[model samples]
Target: TLLEGVEEKIEDITNKLYVVLAALIKGNRANCSNFAQSARLNWLVNRLQSQQASSGALEVLHSVLVDSPEVLNMITEAHILAIIGLLDRNGRDPKVLDVLCSLCVNNGVAVRANQNLICENILQRRDLLLQTALVDHVTW
Candidate 1:
């Protein structure tokens, strides 16, 4: 029932909802633009702050970056920090890095808009970046 769902923690719900939202918006330009313009953009960015939900949030973030051109200009410094955490924070959470890889591999407008900032942060934290790669590459 609706009440039962309400009893579930919002973070738990959003973990799945983010992926569903990402699937819904992937390759859909209008929805992507709407997501960027709406308060949902803030939600997506803030979702990255949640250790429980950041991975699903990353999925939605990757989908939006791949799908929305308008999102590039809309990004903020805080957003950059959140995305940076994907590479070197939260202990290089594999799920987070996997979606971060999508951003790198896709290199859409949002990633390009943020690359200089991202690069600067990466360089400033060289040891962290190397550790992330080592962890990501380790087979066992």
Candidate 2:
């Protein structure tokens, strides 16, 4: 099957998944959350941790996490770890920051991961990124 083949391929799986998930999420939110808890999603999160995530994948991930906060409850620790790492890597990316900030403000997995992300990633590098003169002077 095409879905099974996508699982086997490594080259463009993340990008392919971005399209698949975007469509799935819109078709049925509950099923999408179930899919998010699957091993395939675990693989996707692992890719994000390795910095292999595409912009589309990250955008869909943010949308899923923010739009369906209940999904956070179903996500595994591995997912949390990957999300934390992804957030750290893209702290300066506003899309990532926006989703992460919303997650931190909400309950469940995000609430638990919030302290760690802030203390270890965002806060640790505050002056270098968030509070820098460049951020204040430049737009975007």
Candidate 3:
């Protein structure tokens, strides 16, 4: 349903959604804690399934983590990883017309291969991506 749109404007609208989400949580301690403890964060985690929404998800997640330190201290079973890296495009990403999260790096290779695997849509990998994709410190 997310991809269903005028096509050209899908990205614009998606970016705007992130702007709204970011504005709602930025520097708000209570909002951040509720987001961390509530099921609302699942929506953002699910958004990561879409390559289109993944960048904004990360940016918004960064804001959440930065605004609330309690989130980290409460990571008993899981944790969040604010990964920093550069996405060196081997070629022009024609499919990706625009990106909300900028990967400003000089290197050509980026690690966190687990993320690539979980997000891949191969015959077997597709099941894993659909069933359970890691969003904790290791993958993100």
Candidate 4:
């Protein structure tokens, strides 16, 4: 089962499972996109809501979002919003927030991201504040 490996109590095994899943999603983005947009993706996202196994699920999600922008289109706005909400809840992991911020570069995000406080977080990065602000504004 897809959840079996991820549900392992062993940390190394769980990380390895995430690596394999991320590689699979990257290797065949089209098929993965089909899967990512299905109910299965919802199940995977629910994994992120869990406290123990969320990091592995988050790693897979971050990899997919970074490696396959088209998959983002396959994901619904509500799911994306949920991811952003997760970012706020799990703000300790900067990579997750970075992935969410990267989505701001996508089209139609201005509307979907209205409720997300992406700007406040971006402002915290002095190096990216100006560049991101300009880019986000221009892209909008």
The numbered model that scores best in lDDT is 1
List the lowest-lDDT window of 10 residues for candidate 1. 101-110
TM-scores of all models?
0.68, 0.57, 0.45, 0.55
Off by over 4 Å in 2: 1-17, 36-40, 51-53, 74-81, 87-91, 107-120, 131-140
TM-score of 2: 0.57
Candidates sorted on lDDT, descending: 1, 4, 2, 3
The TM-score of candidate 3 is: 0.45
In candidate 4 the C-alpha lDDT for residue 47 amounts to: 67
Model 4 — TM-score against the truth?
Answer: 0.55
RMSD of 1: 6.5
Best candidate per TM-score, number?
1
Better of 3 and 4 by TM-score: 4
Cα lDDT for residue 79, candidate 2: 60
Cα displacement (Å) at residue 8, model 1: 8.5
lDDT of each: 0.69, 0.60, 0.45, 0.60
lDDT string, candidate 4, 1-140, tens digits:
76777566566676678777777776466745655556776777666665454666776776666565665555666666566556556654675665575566544454255234455544554343233333445443
Model 2 clash pairs are none
Report the Cα lDDT for residue 13, model 2: 66
